[model samples]
Target chain A: MRATLMYGPGDVRVETVADPKLHEPTDAIVRVVQACVCGSDLHPYHSMDATTDGVPMGHEFIGVIEETGTEVSSLANGTLVIGTFSFQDNTCVFCRDGFQTACVNGGFFGSHDVPGAQAEYVRVPFAEGSLVPVPDVSELSDLIPSLLTLSDVYLTGYHGAHMGRVEKGTTVTVIGDGAVGLSAVLASRELGAEQIILMGRHTDRTDLGKEFGATDIVAERGDEGVAKVMDLTDGEGSHVVIEAVGHMPAYEQAYGVIRPGGIISRVGVPQYEKAPVGFGSIFGKNAAVTGGPAPVRAYIDDAIPLVLEGKINPGRVFDQSVALDQVADAYTKMDSREALKVLVKP
Target chain B: MRATLMYGPGDVRVETVADPKLHEPTDAIVRVVQACVCGSDLHPYHSMDATTDGVPMGHEFIGVIEETGTEVSSLANGTLVIGTFSFQDNTCVFCRDGFQTACVNGGFFGSHDVPGAQAEYVRVPFAEGSLVPVPDVSELSDLIPSLLTLSDVYLTGYHGAHMGRVEKGTTVTVIGDGAVGLSAVLASRELGAEQIILMGRHTDRTDLGKEFGATDIVAERGDEGVAKVMDLTDGEGSHVVIEAVGHMPAYEQAYGVIRPGGIISRVGVPQYEKAPVGFGSIFGKNAAVTGGPAPVRAYIDDAIPLVLEGKINPGRVFDQSVALDQVADAYTKMDSREALKVLVKP
Candidate 1:
């Protein structure tokens, strides 16, 4: 089977790898029909982790179940499924409480011992809790993009918006315009946010934001950006400030750009090994800040339905598509901010 | 009028200051009947603020309405009232929302424009908002402590416990042993927290914690304190962590000492300007942290009722008393940690 592997920083290659086979009664072998590069994938791609040899990459996918273990009952041969990026055992106390992402035995694909979906075939563990069946698709053309998003990006944006407590009539200010940020725009809108401000520079980024329902755009950074957003709200700031960029600047800008009793949901993985926090700023305003890796499995049940129903088109995020062999090219384009989301065909 | 004034660090004196008059139409001239020195008083008593010239001090007080402006309708002559430490216009958005201490026009006693209560008379602004009427008590001793705390410490601790969402049967951990922390112990127990831990070193303080409702105590500091708490929880930490000490070490330990999905309410005013936040730690665990100046006006309603009913006995906190002329001795005693709460009589 051909799979995408990271050899080192900026080095992604399509190479023949071991064929995925059922190794446990709770496992299922899936012939991946579609896959895409993810924002998180760029973490290792741009960092030292990309230098690791033969590390299989990619987590998002929609595929057909080629085989199922004896313990698997909900899924069967030919079942079209969306496998969430993180695997979880539904029986855990955390999972039972709707926090499956924090499940005791949860694991992220493409990290450490977990193999990824940028392959001809992949193994899904805890199949019962990991896979969501795609009910019906109005058109075949929509399957790839929608399916590609279920496992990571789209679900992540939904999770981010959810954490921000975005609701109808909420005025949300998204601090980043990355794929997750754009997805947040869609998610916020879906969740009933009346107005959203996409704070970014590039025309390409704002265009995507507009398509997803960003009512305003602030191309400035730091104080100016906060000022622009504050100006938009009569100086009260946004009701919700989504810190999509997990860094000091965005974190600082969020508090400055939000109202006294606002909410800031941060889902971005911090680059600094020890991310700095500002307690005085956060406590002073009586605001709430919370986020984490999207519990894709928890969101897929809803996001997958939206995609299949054609009510949402998260697949439009992919501005370009490339062969598995062109994985490195995809990384180069995304790292340079030239592309929004890229689809990788195995 | 003779008022408690700070001449220099650790130097307090009772001197004649200008008698307060009707500063605003809504202001009431209250003849202070009972006033107490708070742990926070030590901040200025032992701080640079004390080294300054003529700093008026004292926030906690119970008083008689000596005079009321024409527009003041809430009380009449000779009405007994327990004034909130911070004056707020109850009609403002923050006060209407139950955050009176943070009202836009809110004024804290003893700091600049908000005159301290350790005087013969105080200019109580927004009289309707700051005054809580209590039923007459035959035992004058039973009423002073409750009235003193109404201004700051007790209500602040109650607010802290409330913010942490501590409820009946929930386990609670209070991280500071100041007056507010001691008050939090009472608040926790009154609110029905099953087990309360008060982390302190002084025998008097620990005993006070127990008398108030602390079920356990961990005298260790930093990592040792956190480890002891974790051990107390069988390594799961408490369901709620009340951070009363405002510093990085205590703040960090507060986060480390809580289990997954715990609530951390930081009411302590951080001394180091700004403390770096633990973003990932909070997000990954689905935790929440919030709090600021106690909305004294908000909790006074609840606290005053508890006091009148004798459901909560906060009067025990005042371990000593002194004549108003001995303000200097009062400051010195509290600064040396020899007293938990001090009362002053005019």
Candidate 2:
């Protein structure tokens, strides 16, 4: 089986590796049909130290269940399925509360212990809870890319808007121009945000954001960006700010462009541990800060219908696609900003 | 007019100051009936630098309207009223959104410009918006203390519980057993929280907390406190943590004791400017941090009925009282922890 692996920073490769096997009664063997490079992958891509034993890569994927453990009662082999980035029992108190990412029995894929989805065959734990079975899409194969996004990015964006409580008449400012940010623009619109402001420097991405429901785009960064957003919002900031970029400046922009009593939902995996939250920042305006690893498993059921019904086309974010053998090129393209997101066919 | 003034750290004085005069068409002069020393007052009491000019020292008060400017039509002279700590023209967008503390034209009363409430007469700006008229209470004079608390402490506690979304069947952990914390216990009970855990070392205060609504009291701090709360919740942590103590340790305990997907509503005036908000803290659990100065004016209307009917007795937090000339001793008693809170009559 061919699998993606990272040897070190800027080093990505596809090499023949042993096929994943069922290790627990709750596990299922998934024959990957599609997987993608994530922006978070870029974090390790830029700074991961050299290692002789390469790290498995990728967390998002849609596949067919090749084998199921005895304890996995709800799912069957050969069924098309979407696995959330993090595998969970989905019955834990936290999972039941819509925070499957924090499930007591859950663990994220692509870690050293749990080989990743960007492989020919991947082992999914808590199969019944982590994998949502999709209807026979033999003829509706075109929906694959969109369904694949529900594994992570799309749901992450949705989590931002959902946590921020974006709704009708809300003015939402989405920070970052990446796939997640664009997805947030779409999610905000889907949630009935009256105004969508996309803060991004990339014209191509911002243009896509506009198409996705961004009524305004602020290409500026930092102070200028905040000023422009405030100007657009009539000197008051947006009612909700979706922070999709994980940088410190993006966090600053999030707090800056949020109106008094508004919410700043950050889906970006933060790059820094400390940020100002004192009287000078969120406290002064009574702003709330919320968002974390999206409980994609919790949202997958509802999101699948939206994608199946063609209400959203989150798959458009995949601007480039590559064969398994060209996985390294996929990473290079995404890392260099040549591709919004790269889909890999195994 | 006699007023309480903080000349420096450990130096409080009762001095004769010029009677407040209407400085804005929106202003109203209120003759103080009762004003209380707050937990926040201790911030300056411990660190205030010596100066030739003293800072006015109180913000909570219920009083009779001595005079009303031309624009103050909704309120009349001689009417008993409660003024929120921060004065705002409640018509502002933020005020309408239930965040009057962040109103564009709002300013706190104890600042350099606005004389504090611990005086014979205090000028309240945005009178129509800041003052909530109380029904004739001369016959029910006992309710004055409680009504005065609605201006700050009690409302601050309500803000914490409200922001934390405490409701039926929810488990709430309240940090700090100060006036605000006790108020939060009361507020949590009022909001239908099924389990209320009050975290404090003071038995006297915790007893008051229990009386207010705390079902459990944890006299521990730091890791032990976290362990105790986790143990009490069957290792799941509380559904909401109301941070009533504004220090770093309190903030740390807040994140520590919250269940995944819970809310940490901080009403404590944060003493620090930075805190960790990365994966190791709030983000890891999908916990939200929300709260700031209470928009008391927005809540005063609903709270007035509760206090008027004797359903709550927030004024019990005022454990000591002082006359206009004894205002200096009020601060000393509170500063020394000899009194939980002190009510000043001017």
Candidate 3:
């Protein structure tokens, strides 16, 4: 089996690796049908995240169950499924409360001793709780990207909007023009937000954002960007602010554009060690800060149907696709902003 | 009229000042029946807050309306009312949304030209919107202290619990031993929390917290404090953490004790300029940070009845009393920790 491995910063290699097998009674083996290079993957690619030698690299995938362990009765071989980034036991206290990312018996894919999804075949722990079965479709060529996204990005976008409490007739400002940000725009529209503003300078991303139901676009940055958003909101800030970029400036921008009593929901993997969440910045406005790793498993069930029904086209973010051997170029394309998302056909 | 003035850091003086008079069509002049030193007042006294020469000090007061401007219709001469720290016109967008602290065309008491409530007679702007009237009772001697708390501390406490989303059966951990922290314990009980823990060091304050419905008290500081709280909460942490102290350490304590998806509601006037709200600290836990300056005016109506009925005794925090001439001594006592809260009779 071939898998993507990162030896160090700016180092990515698609090399032959040992195939995955059942490691636990609750585990299942899945043959990867589709996966992608996530923005978070850039954290290690750019050397921003600590990485050891030869770590398996992906956490998003949709696949077919090839085998199952003795204890896994809920799923069978040959079932089509989507798996969240972290494998969670659904019965854990945190999982029951919709915080599957913090599940007691679960941890992230590609982490220590866990096989990643960016391979021909991968072992999925806690299969019954971590994998969501999708309807069997005769042709999956078009649905693969969208289904793959439900494993991470799409659900993360939904989580941002949900945490931001975007409601009907409310104004929403989504910072960052990445795939997740565009997905947030789509989710905000799905949640009935009356005005959706996408803050991005890129024409390519903003074009997709507009198609995702963004009512406006602010090309400015920093204080200028905040002023533009405030101007659009009639001098009061937006009712809900989605922070999909995890830098200090991005957080500051989100805080700056949130109206009094509004919420700032962030789904971006934070790049900073500490965010200045002070009373002078947030308390006087009575604002709130929420969002983290999305409970992808919690939203996958509801989100799959939307994609299945063709109500949303989150797959549009996949502007580039490549074969397993070409995965290295895919990372470069994404890193250089030449691609919105890179679809990996294993 | 006599008022407390901050000539500089650590310099407080009780001096005769010009009596207040109606200045706006919506203004009213109130003869302060009672005023108290707020925990926030200590900010300027301890040199943590910027102090200017002769700045009148105080924002919490219960007073009798002595005069009303031509446009003041809801409140009139002789009405007893509790004034929030800031005066707000309830018609503003923020105020209508229940965030009176961020009201437009409104500002805090003791700010610039705005006279502080800790004087014989103070001019109140936006009288009808800023003041909550108490039922007139002939013998009001015993009810004065409790009603006075309605202006700030108690309402701030209630705001913390409300923002933290304290529900019927959740566990609540309040971080602070000040008047506001004690008030939060009382408020959490009123909000129907099944288990309440107060984290404080002082025997007197913790005893009062227990009386206010604290089921447990963790007297440890720093990591030990968090460990004690985690041990009490089945090693997961509390469902709701109330940060009644405004400093960074209190905020960190609150962050340390919150469960995944839990909320930290803070109301203490933040003395620090920035707080480190990192993803490592908050996001993975799926926790939230909410609460600000209490929208005291918004909760005053419901809270007043609680105080009037003796359902809560926030005034018990007032362990000492002083005449108007001894207002300087009041600040000293509170600053030196000799008094939990001080009551001033003008």
Query: Candidates' DockQ values?
Result: 0.39, 0.87, 0.78
Candidate 1 lDDT over A117-145, as tens digits, reads 88888898888888877645421455667
> What ranges in model 2 sit over 4 Å off?
none
Residue-level lDDT of model 1, residues B73-107, one tens digit each, is 97887878888888888887556767665577876
Query: Poorest 10 consecutive residues of model 1 chain B by lDDT?
Result: B272-281
Highest-scoring model, TM-score: 2
Greater lDDT among 1 and 2 belongs to 2
List pairs with backbone clashes in candidate 2.
Answer: none
lDDT of each: 0.79, 0.91, 0.88
Error of 1 at B274 (Å): 4.0
- What is the fnat of model 1 with respect to the true interface contacts? 0.29
lDDT of 2 at B287: 90
Which portions of model 3 miss their true places by more than 4 Å?
A: A48-52, A138-141, B48-52
lDDT of 3 by residue, A1-346 (tens): 9998887777888989778878899999998888899999988888745456587989998899999999999898888888888899988999999999989998999954896777888889999999998857532657888888898988899999999888899899999999999999999999999999999999999999999999999999899999999999998899999999888889889989999999999898888757666766888788999899999888887888898899987988899999988998989999999999998989
Off by over 4 Å in 1: A21-25, A49-54, A68-71, A135-141, A273-280, B46-50, B135-141, B207-211, B276-280
RMSD of each: 3.1, 1.2, 1.5
Could you tell me the lDDT of residue A326 within candidate 1? Answer: 80
What's the lDDT for candidate 1?
Answer: 0.79
